[model samples]
Target: MKQFWIVGLGLLPLVAGCSLFETNPVPPSPALTGVSAQDAAWKDQIKRVRGAEEARFEPLVEAREAVSAALAQQGVNDYDAASLEEAQQALDAAESGWAEVANKRRPNGDKLAAIATDAHRATRLAEIARYAAVREINLEKLVAVNDQLETREQSQPTRQARPVTGDARDLVGQKVVPDQLGEVSFQPGTARMKPASQEIVRQLAGLLERYPSVGVAVFGHTDNVGPSAASLERFVKANPKLEQQAPSQAEKVRAFNLALSAARARTVAQLLVDNGVPARRIGARGFGDTRPVASNDTQAGRQANRRIEAVIVPGPDSPEAQRARAENAGS
Candidate 1:
């Protein structure tokens, strides 16, 4: 009876209603949608990037970051549109190369080399774009400041014209080069004016005192000589155009010279103030090694380059303007 029961149980699976021997088909995987689909794509990209990085194509990663950083900065596209566009194209090429390499079981060495070259170029261009953008922004600020100064000058009350004579006559109508008026000298590299410079300063102060309505702009300049490495680096970082045009020390020296020239201008302006010239009538600035009257290759030329210039701008009621008006009236 027990054996008959066992046989019956074994035959049960063969019966139509029994499901023990039949296998169940797995349900189709749910279609990926929304966040899951996006997540999958991101994971795939991450895997490819990881593969690229492991294959020693890290420069591409750096280039991508650099391009992204440049785009993030203000006015990059506006100031350096050409460089930015080129950088983007180079980066795209590098990335495409990387994708092709990553997809293959074995990456070609020549293709990897090309990708690296493109990545390096993209990085350099991106850096240049950022530098140009910042420089243009600074220049715009300077122009705005100059406009404000002009506005302030226009707001001042008109004064009666005064008589001009001697040194004042020579200076009032033109940009007075300090070398023409007994060169303004400084003590070594310092901003302190030497005793020899006193005569020039006195001459300028006297001219300003004679015509109170006349405004003077003092410009100081220097030769290309001494500059610290750090300062040079900073200058290169700030002025990419300069570095691109003149990579030598001649251009880098401007970084140090700029500060020295500014100080010298201020010193001269201060001296004029001490000699009774109104501070309001004076504006001081520096040109560094940019505007050289002579070549910096020679000592005399460098000495000529390192000097102060005063530009006297006569107001509507100034002596020079009055002289012009009187001459016109007589004619």
Candidate 2:
């Protein structure tokens, strides 16, 4: 019986072979040739992305440098590993985002180009944000350390021996201190400081030298006579008033007036710096016809208003203020 059952076994093997032959082979997709139109488009996109990324690298590098400097200054000695990890993570994320966009096929190349441009901007902003975080963290650590030091100093005997002064310090926060006299005149328009006013600058410099730690602010002022913006423009130009134009043309006249005032302030600052005063100890600002000490309508008042002033800042001992007071007393 067993021998008889083997009769159809050969046919079964034949059926198995047929089944194997009938199995479907995978159909090949189009090959990615370098010279194809699609490849050209892809290359263009890559170029755009690469160009944008390259442009952003400089600012990113600067931000990173600033962060590194701040961290070092803050005494963050143990942050090397953490800093490296953060930088690597940022790079990885940027690369991954760029790759994802680069691999995509867009029907509108212009749109993708625009997107690449925006992505570059985004990356720059991200770098700034990241560096800002680093700075903030480092600053916090610095403040903490400083506070600790201050506390320790306060607990020491030296701090107890040194008595603190009760007088309030006069610290102006980046404000432009206007001249005591509102403005100066140079024959309706000119850069030259008036001969009579030259002594004023000499006096101011003498005052400044007495206070090495104090900073002075020299501000110029003018009378209102024209469109504010136009007057400011003309003032910067320092152009003289045209003889053909009426002197009553307040705008033109005021432009000359303010220009003279600004020149006076600059001259005073230069004189101070030239006399061994550090340049950082002085700041110059110009306000064209904005703040008037006297009425412009009256000739006497206007004459009084058109003048140069010197603001003497007192130093740690306010030596300049004291000297100024002594000179005033002597006068």
Q: What C-alpha lDDT values do all the predictions have?
A: 0.62, 0.42
Q: Tell me the number of clashing residue pairs for each predicted model.
A: 0, 3
Poorly placed runs, candidate 2 (over 4 Å): 1-188, 225-260, 314-331
The 10 consecutive residues of candidate 1 with the worst lDDT sum are 12-21
Where is model 2 poorest over a 10-residue stretch in terms of lDDT? Answer: 10-19
The TM-score obtained by model 2 is 0.36
Q: Provide the clash count, candidate 1.
A: 0
Residue pairs whose backbone atoms clash in candidate 1: none
Displacement of residue 161 (Cα, Å) in model 2 is 37
What does candidate 2's lDDT look like per residue over 1-331, in tens digits? Answer: 1122122111111111111112122222223444455444433544334545432322223334534443443223332334434544454444444445544544244433334343444334333334334333422332243335435645777622211112213321111122332233444434466665555555555545543544554555655554455655555455444544444465565656565566666666676666666554554444567556679898877665555444333232344334534653585
Per-residue error (Å), model 2, residue 281? 1.0
All predictions: root-mean-square deviation over Cα?
31.7, 31.1
Candidate 2 positional error at 50, Å: 26
lDDT of 1 by residue, 1-331 (tens): 2232222222111111111111121222234457656344323333334534444456677788889989997899897889889999999998888878765655555676677678878888887787566545533443344345435545779622223455533434344544246578898667988897887889878766666656565778898886567756775777777668766675466666887898888888788878987654555667788767688899999898888876555433455445544664585
Clashing residue pairs, backbone N/CA/C < 3 A, model 2: 183-306, 183-307, 222-289
